[model samples]
Target: MANYKPDLSCQNKFISVNFSEQIQLGTFEYALYYIVENKLDLSGSYAWYDKTGAVTYPPSGMLKIILLGYAHGLISSRRIARLTKQVFTL
Candidate 1:
């Protein structure tokens, strides 16, 4: 067996968020997230045999954020991607 040790410097290098303050009831984002999780079935659309490695978020999550961005008049791909991270992280 190989020995392992924790890195002390990286222990404090993390960002924290307050989920209760970020997601509120009756909000569009919350509603969309709720529908995506509880109401919609997206597993059928995901690939099963793909070997693309790990993704930051699932494909369905990216699609939902992109669609939401488009609905809000965001046409640029970069902008959409940035907004997707921001909105999802919150």
Candidate 2:
């Protein structure tokens, strides 16, 4: 099995957010999250990693971020980085 960074969706901070509640049932974000988490086979992403190294971010998480960026018409790496850092509710 591939080692992954912990899912921080439920982690409490100064501003608490229930991520599940943020993504509504019928939205595109919800659909994308569901398909990537439940349907996609991402084992291929782990093939290049050596388990001896540090735990990696989940491929599903990365894919979701990238796809969401693309969906918002953000193709530039800088814009995507900004999107990840700046955008909370999309």
Candidate 3:
């Protein structure tokens, strides 16, 4: 076997930033991408920021969570919310 690795082995090499991928899931992923890019407010924009004080992922956190919900078929935001809690509770 060759003692080498593929070009995509780098951490940032896998994502395509073209914004033109025609896949069905592209819209969902792109939505989250732009939300973070522009630093736009998210669903919990009205919430008070706890200790860290930066709106606590106030940009694409919800979008990212919702996208993960869609990817894993978590139809309810309540369920997705639970996932977020569980993840951090680890």
The candidate scoring highest on TM-score is 2
TM-score for each candidate, following the candidate numbering: 0.58, 0.81, 0.40
Provide the lDDT at 58 for model 2: 78
Q: Using lDDT as the measure, name the better of candidate 2 and candidate 3.
A: 2
> In candidate 2, what are the lDDT values of residues 1-90, reduced to their tens digit?
667787777666635776767898999999999999889888788676666667888777889999988998989988898768875544
What lDDT tens digits, residue by residue, belong to model 3 across residues 26-79?
A: 575665565554766543543443444322443244556677687889999889
* Candidate with the greatest lDDT versus the true structure: 2
Alpha-carbon local distance difference test for all models = 0.61, 0.81, 0.53
Residue 24: error of model 2 in Å?
0.4
Off by over 4 Å in 2: 1-3, 88-90
Compared with the true structure, the alpha-carbon lDDT of candidate 3 equals 0.53
lDDT of 1 by residue, 1-90 (tens): 112233222232354644435778998877876787688777665544254544334545666667778878999989998876686455
**Local error of candidate 1 at 71, Å?**
2.8
**Which runs of model 1 end up more than 4 angstroms from their true locations?**
1-13, 19-21, 48-56, 85-90
Flag the better candidate by lDDT, 1 or 2: 2
